[model samples]
Structure formats: C-alpha cells, structure tokens
Target chain A: MNISEIRVLIGDDSILARKQMKDILEEVGVKNIEEAANGQEVVEKFRSFKPDIVFLDIVMPVKDGTVAISDICAEFPDAEIIVISSVGTQSYLKQAILNGAKDFVQKPISSSKIEEILLSRFERS
Target chain B: MYTQLFGNYLLSKNIITPDQLVDAIRKRNDVFVQPNTIAMHFKLISATDAEYVTKIATDKDSDFISTAINLGYFTREAYDEVKDNTLPEYLFLGQSLINDGILSSSKLEEYIVEYQSNNEMIDLELYSDQKDNLDQLLLNLFIIANEELPLYIGKYINLLFTNLIQFIGEDFTPLNFLPCEEYPVSLCSYQRINGVHPLTMYLDLDEKVALEFASRYVGESFTEIDEYVKASLEDFLNLHNGIYNVNLSNESSIEMKLDPPVFIEDTSITPGEKEQLYMLPIVYPFGTINFLFEIEKQETTSLF
Candidate 1:
C-alpha cells in the first residue's frame, strides 16, 4: 500500500495532459504508471494493466470517458476511477459521479490536487 | 487594442505601411514619461529635487516614487496624483505616431475624432473609461459573418484578449480581420464546440512563433515543434474554449461541449466549403499568430 507500489493509469486524448499527469504522479512518489489516448484504450489498458487508480478524460475520439468509466466500473466494481476533464459542467460532473467515478478534477489539472488525492488514497490504503 | 484597431484602419486605407504600423506599435511602448518628466510637467517638485530623486532611485534600484518619498521630496498623495494624471495609452500611441512622422499632430487629432465618431464611441475617454471603451471597441470592430450567429463575436474576442493578457504577455496588438479560404499554417491547434450552435476555433502560427508561444505558456524553453509544443497549444485552445463555453452556459443557459483539440503540424488548413472563416491576426513581440474561427450557418432558430 506504499505510494511507490501504487499503479496509476492516465487516459487523455492530449499527450501533453498524460505527460503532465505522469510527471506529477512521479513527483508524488508513484512509480508504476500507464497512459491511454482514448476511451477504448482506457478500457483495454484497464483490463491489461489493472491499475489501482485511473484518471480519465471526458472527451476522446473513438470512445469517451463516461462510457469507459461505466464499462470499467461495471466490470471491476472495486476500480477507483477519477474523471479528469476540461469541461466541469454540472451535468458532466453528475454523470461522471453517477457512472461510479471516485472523484473529478477539472483541467489544467494542478499538481497540488493530484498530490492531495494521492496522499488521501495512501492514507486510506 | 484601440491602437491596433486604428493602425489597421490606417493600413486598410493605405495611409500607413505594415512596417510603419509595426514601428508605431514598438514606439508606443516607449512613450511613457519618466517621473522627473511628470514632476516637471506638473511642477510638483523642482528640477533639482527631481534630479536628486532620480539619482537616489537609480543608486538604490528603486522606483522614482519610493525614492522621492524616502528623500522627502514628495508626499504619497503627490505621487499618486502624478501617476494617475499621466497620459492614456491611446494618446501616447498617437503622440508616438506623430513623433515618428507617420502622422502630423493635426492629422492625428482629425483621425481620432473620425475613429471615435465612426465607431459611435465619442464619449469613450482613453484612460478613465477603459473597460467600457474596450467593450465598445470590440463590439464595433468585430464583424459577424453569419447573421444567424448571435452577437457573440464581441464576447469571444473580449475573452480572447483577456486570456491572451493573462497567459501570454500583454505586449501584443490585434490586427484587422481578413477573410481567406486557406491559410498556410506551420502549426495549428483547434477545437470544435457542439451544442445549440457548432463552431470550430483555430490557433495558427508559424513554427518559430509556435515555439515562442508554447514556451511562454508553459514557462519552458522550446526550440522545436515537438509533442510538448503541440500539447501546450492544444491545452491553451481547450482552456480558452472551456472558459468560453462556461460563460455561454452561465449567461445564456446554452450548454455546449468541446471535442478534444487536434494539432496540425507543418501543413496548410483550409476552411470548409460552406463555412465562413475569418482570420484575426494578432501581432506579438515574438511574431504574428493568427486565430481562425470557422463558423457555419446554423439552420436552427436564432439563439440570440
């Protein structure tokens, strides 16, 4: 349950977003990390990597984060998915939470917020 | 912004060359009067006192006002009064243009009157009513191509300038709008807004300008159009479009969603066959970056 032992997955259409999140996660002492470019990739990576935490963007090309969240949650009920999006409308947030996402962070995602989430997850684990 | 608008007007009329416009803009930044000059103008302090204050300020690496205060040359109230009474930006630009021989003082005055009258901003003072003046200028300057689209061009351009000032440096001048079917872009990032109305917004620049822009946005040095540069441009477009959508939603009760930003590298991008695309050129110290908005004519009821 140590921070470095926790596996992390970042699903974002923007390579910049994924890299930024990965850098912050690394800074926070998370060693094992994976990235996906779209919703389909998110699902595929989730099944293959079985990451402990997933950060999913709401908008993508092939599939979207909402469906990805639903599919992952339905299959892995214990999966901890955090919806990361640029759009933070009320309806989007509600739909994300409804689809069984553990939390939501609006983009330009801050490192402090990521650190806080990681710290809380560390404590809980 | 008004300076740029006026410069564009002059350019369109063939009264000033592009080089002149750029020169005037560069000179605009140098038009500020030093504290000694202001003090001399207002007779707030003697020339000797001003010189003494300037010497102390330089030696201490402090500002004229602070040095004057420490030297007991001027009170805080006097300093504030001098600062507030300085010339406005537009006037400074006009004076700079005149000094550069681009226009005579009388011609400058004539043009100012004409510009104000034509734009129906006669009451727009250069300094005191800036926010309102900008609102008026943007509303008057931006011409919406499609009749169906709301008068949101002003709002969009306002938000653009605000964000540019926030993220990028405020040292930029927005040029006149030009209509073109295709732009030879070295680097471009765009996002589509879908909902009650659909539109595509693009940020396009040359590779060198893109590098400088990306570096400015992320506070990092970028020498090439790499993944990080592309992502930074995409993120900027997304961030700006996100704010625009949120504003529209909050103010007009219109919900809109953004598609993930797409980056086009080393290619020319063309507007859709039926879409009306307008290119707004913004001149920065680094280079010119063009913003292209391709808005299709919606067949639905007018949202405005």
Candidate 2:
C-alpha cells in the first residue's frame, strides 16, 4: 500500500500506545486515521470504515490482533496491517508476519522504529 | 537507593569516611537482628508470626517488624519500638548531612520517623553460615547507591552496578521489598533461574511505572554508561556488604566475596515468586531506570 494513500486504523489495548501510534502516523503523513481498543473492535471498524492500513496490538482482550488480522485479511486481502506488541518473542513476530501483517512494532512505543519500518516497507511497495 | 543518595549527599560534603559508613550499616543489621527473631527470643511475638515475618522480610527484602505489623501479626507498638530503636547511623548519617544546617529538632524527629519507615534490613545468617556482614552491607550499599546517585552520572549506572552485584555471591536476585515514592526502580533478582540451590536478592519498587531513570541534568534521559557509574555501582555493592557484615565482626566473620560480572543482553526474565517484583521510576536526565531486587525467605524450621 502507498504510505500517502494509506487510510489507517489504529488498535491497541493501551491508551498510551494507541495515541502514540496515531501521533506517529500523523508525523509520517498518513492523513486518514481511525482508532480501536481491541482486536474485535479493529475488525468491526475495518469492515465499516474500510481503512487502507491498520496498526494492531497482538495482545488484547476479546479477539486479539492475530485473530483480528486473520479475520480482516481473509475478507480484505489487500488490507495493509501492522502488529504491535511488548513481548516481542520470535513466535509472536513470526505469527504476526504469517497472519498477513505488513510489519510489527514493539511496545513502550519507539517513534523512530515505527517510522523506519513504515518507510522501508511502503517506500519499496 | 535512598541510602546511597544520602551517602553521596554526605560524601560531597566529606562528612564520613567510606569505611565508617560501611561500619554503621553492618552494625545496624547485626545489632538489630530480625525484630521478629528478637521478639521470639524474648517471647514477645508468637513463633508462627516470627516465622512469617522472617519469610516476608527475606522474600520481600522488607523489615520484619513492619511486614509483621502490615500483616497484622504484631501491634503498632511492637513495630515502632524495634524500628525506632535500631537506626543504622551510616544510613541515617547521609540524611543528617543533607539537612545539616536545615534540619530542626522537629525535622530530626521526622527524619527519625522516616529512617524507621525507610530502613529495611535483613539477617541472611539465619539461614546460612555466611557471616561476612561487611560484604552484605556493601552489596546493599551498591544497590542503594545505584538508585541514589544523581542523574548527572546517568541512570544506566544502576544496571552497571547490578552487574557488579552479580559478583558478590554465587548468584544474586533483586527483591521488591518495599513500596517506593518517586522515580521508583524495578525489582530484579539474579539466581540460577532454575537450579538445585539458587541464591536470590530481593528488590522493592513502584509497580505501576516502567524502569527509566533521570539523566545527569534536568529534562534529559540519563544515557551515558561510563567508568564513574561502573565504579560507583561497584563501590555501592562493596559498602552494602561491608555494612551487612560489620556488626558481627566481634562474634563471627562470614566469608563475603564477589565474582566478576557477566553482561547478558536485554531479554525478558520473570523472577517468579521468591523474587517479588516492585517498581518505582526515578526522574533523571532523560527517563527513569526501574529499580528492582528480590528477597530470599528463611525456612520456618531455620527461624526457630
């Protein structure tokens, strides 16, 4: 998905992290943005709003990001999604990548890291 | 950590020798055994309660008296008497120096109360033959100093100091013994995560916050990890051991020694229950360094 053309949805359990991702997206020049608190919320918003990109937290109550990512991807194969987590175990990372997320971000949110990943992936795509 | 902060505050003014400071802390522990132990020896507190306090204090790295009172095992009178009666001069001296000209009689009274509230010393010998009070005091000093050192030195100095503490014994763990007020550090314990006989250290901190420390200067995260930080952390551990063993000098000398530090990359390791977790953030140059430690409990049979 084109970074500028990205209409993104942000979903995470932590209020701090969600806001941080939103601010980072704005900094990166993504204009259209929506927010959600959990995986199910992300799915509902994805179906209704049909954002071009989604930043999802892997560990959340009521259908985690992994489930949400699969649910969204199964329906919207072209949807751009990124999984975020604090416990960056290799398993979680691999699962996220396998579930059709474009990328992943670690928690205690680092702005530079997210920006770098987005720029590298989207710039190439 | 506050203890070391008090130490630096004192050292900057040249109030006490490093040796003297160590002596006071060591004596405090030996002089004031576990209040529960003392209480039990005198038949003041029940055997069950004493054993419970020993476990809580050791596992939590907290004061036996207060832990007992908090647990409702002892009355307020029992906790106060023991806490107030035993003041580690070395630990309090730093605070004394900070308020040297400023501390009034009433303020001194307050410091005494705070000292009672803040101080939490344990006797490891209750379980082991180790008698090196100095070494224990030094270890405590190092942990305390790492937390106490100013931001000018950077907060990572604490991690460096923890590296040094790993040397003090075969294994180490940080206990989350007490609740911290500000810039709380994360509790950490270093032991053979899984072994037959694992040694643990207890740490206390504020659990709500992450581990970050203030920088040397205001409005910055303390990032620099230099020799000063390394040496200071080392010294703090040394003093903690020294103080821990000092008071026992006359009765017996526990062999306290340390090994070299081995740095492990940043990875997540859960301390489990023996090493309770407490967290508090310290505002430094940049961010807070979470302070952490673990406490090893005394066997009920051993306490008796």
Candidate 3:
C-alpha cells in the first residue's frame, strides 16, 4: 500500500483536536480519513470505517480510549490503535499498553511524531 | 511570573498607564535585548555609534547583533553568552515600556528596584522560571490566599498561568482572585480532577471574550459562539487539566482522573459543602474572562 492510500481514524471529544489531527494527516498526503468524537464512535468506526490505523484519545464522553482500545484489539486482534492523550502518566501508559495499544503519543499533538508513527505502521503493514 | 507580578505592581502603584502596560506586554516577546542596545547600555559603543550600527545593519538587511559583532564592538562569545542567557521578563516589560515612550531608560531601572523592594522579594532574577519562586510569588500575590484556599491550589493556578502563555496569546493579565460562594456562569466549560487532590475548574466567559479566546486557541477567527466554539473551550479546559494531571502524576506520583469537559450555559457554579471556592478574572486585550475553581478538602491526611 502507498503512503497516501491508507485510511486513518481520529478519536477525540474535541472538534479542534480532530481538525488539527485531520489537517496534519492530509498534509502528510493521506487521503482517506474518518473521525470519531467519542470512544464509542471510535470502536464503531474501527469496525465499520475499517481504518488502517487509529489515533485515539484516552478520555472521552461515553467510552474512554482505553476501553475502546481493549474492545477493538480483542475483537480484531490485528488492530493498529495508537493512544494519544495529555495524561501520559505511568498508570495510563501501562493501562494503554496492557489494553493492546500499539503506541502512545502525548497531547498538543506534533506533526513529525504523527508522520513518524504513520510511516512505521505503514512499513510494517 | 515576575513579569505579570511586576506589571500588576506597577498598575497598583499607578506608575505606568494601562494602555502602555498592555502594549508593552504584547510586544515583550517580539522585542528582545538587541546587540546595539546592549552595547550602548554597557558603554561598549557610544549612542551615536549604536545608531550608526543599526543603520548599517538595516541597510545591509542584517541584524544589530551581527553588525555589532562585525564592527568589533563585542566578541562573538560574549554575544553568544548574552543570547543564551534569558533576561528576566520584567526587564523585557521595561524594555517594551521604554520603546513605546512610556518611560525613560533610567525610570525603568528605578521601577525595577522599587518592585523588588516593595514586594520584599529581593531575588527578582530567580523568578524567571523557577517553580519554587512562583509558589512564593503566588503566596505574595495573594498574601491571605493560603488561609482561604489550600496548599496545592496555588500550584494549580501557577500551572494554569504557564499554560495560558503556552497555548493562548500572552496579551492577557490575570487579575487578583477573590473568594466567592456562588459564581453565575455565562457561557462556561468545566472539567473536574478527582483523586488525592480533587478540584472542579470552571471557565466562564461572556460572549465577547469567548469569541476572541476561541479565535486565539484554535488559530481561527470566530466571530460568533457556536458548537465549535463551545467545544474549543471544553478542549482547552481538558488540555490544561490533562497536562496538570500529567504533571501531578509525573512529579509527585499523584494520580488523578479527569472527566470529559462539558459546556454549560445559563447556570450557577457554586462550591460544595467541603469546597474552597475562588474566582479569578483574566483580562485579554480583546475582552475579559472569569476562571473559577473550587477544591475539596481532603478527608484523610495528605501523604506528601
């Protein structure tokens, strides 16, 4: 698959955050992208939108990114879910990893970091 | 820390005009200690020579630092050292004032001395970024706040101030906070941090400030309040609280959980029975905002 061919899913309660990430992804030449405003939508979109990779925030309204991560991974087992959040503490990081997240990125998301993560996953897939 | 404090101090003493203070604050980060100014200040070059260096640099489309270095007024290593060392923010404020003709160079020096002595914190230089200095400065800013609020609440406010400069524009001034039993909310977004130190923080904004603040936060022009603007406010509160929780967890091994930020309108935010409440008014150049916070007193003794 080409770099721009992969579909991306962004999950966060914040509209500004979603736009920021979506803009960066488009800038990186990714065309197909889906967005979820909550963790429940994230899980639902993972099953329906079937994105190649997912960027998830831990804290959401209905369901959090941690539980969403566990749900997607347990069901699919091959889901590439990345946890992006401001709470980068040990407990959250450990819980995210134990929940089967592929990686963790801190909030005020950086473009270079996103590009790096996307390229790594793209190459692996 | 000292920049805002000293600015507030000057305002309290009726030294500088409010318009001049606002202009100075907005221009501080844009104007740094230039080489010609430093040369003239240290008498390394005459005032006329500094002007000539500036002219030469402008004509050459270069900077005062490189022009001065090329003119052999100061060595490259000395210029590097000065550039590497950040002058205190209050000094930048002074520079801003002088550049805007609000105060002469000597008058600014006098105010600096007065500010340090009046505040009784002689080590004004140490407050540049030192966290401990901030805690002391916060205590000094509100001498009776500790008695009203609590220990970590001051820390939380300090972190909030830092985040304001980090995320939002630096044109706002945080006015003194007053204790309040009930705060009427206009357009408000709130998030709670619950754990060892539990607190509910509410950001209330009248429509005007909300528009300007959302514009600054999202880097887009927002003239009217909509779902997007309200969501932006919630996101900012969430961002600040998340970073605060991260800091607490990393630094103090204090773990706290945050709920999603919610947008509430036409409501009253009051303190709970065991909560200590306070409201701080922040003045941006565009408008004003009120950020209210209430922290619950712990049932058990504090571990740290």
Instruction: Arrange candidates, best lDDT first.
Output: 3, 1, 2
- Candidate 2, residues B123-219, lDDT tens digits: the string is 3112123223323343344334444322211212343333333332111122222332322223322211112112222222222211221112112
Question: What CAPRI-style quality would you assign to candidate 3?
Answer: medium
- Runs of candidate 2 exceeding 4 Å displacement: A108-110, A121-125, B1-176, B179-304
Candidate 3 per-residue lDDT, tens place, A11-115, comes to 998888898999999888899999999989999999999988999999899999899999999898888889999888888899999999989998888999998
Q: What tens digits encode model 1's per-residue C-alpha lDDT throughout B191-223?
A: 999976677898998888889999998878999
TM-score to true structure, per model: 0.75, 0.38, 0.77
Model 3 lDDT per residue over B107-175, tens place? 666677677766556466555545555666676565343465666766677778778877786556666
Leading candidate by DockQ:
3
Candidate 1: regions farther than 4 A off: B1-19, B26-99, B103-134, B144-150, B298-304
Where is model 3 more than 4 Å wrong at Cα?
A123-125, B10-109, B117-129, B143-146, B297-304
lDDT of each: 0.76, 0.46, 0.79
Q: For residues A54-87, what per-residue lDDT tens digits would candidate 2 score against the true structure?
A: 7787766678777788898899988889776643
Decide which is better by lDDT, 2 or 3.
3
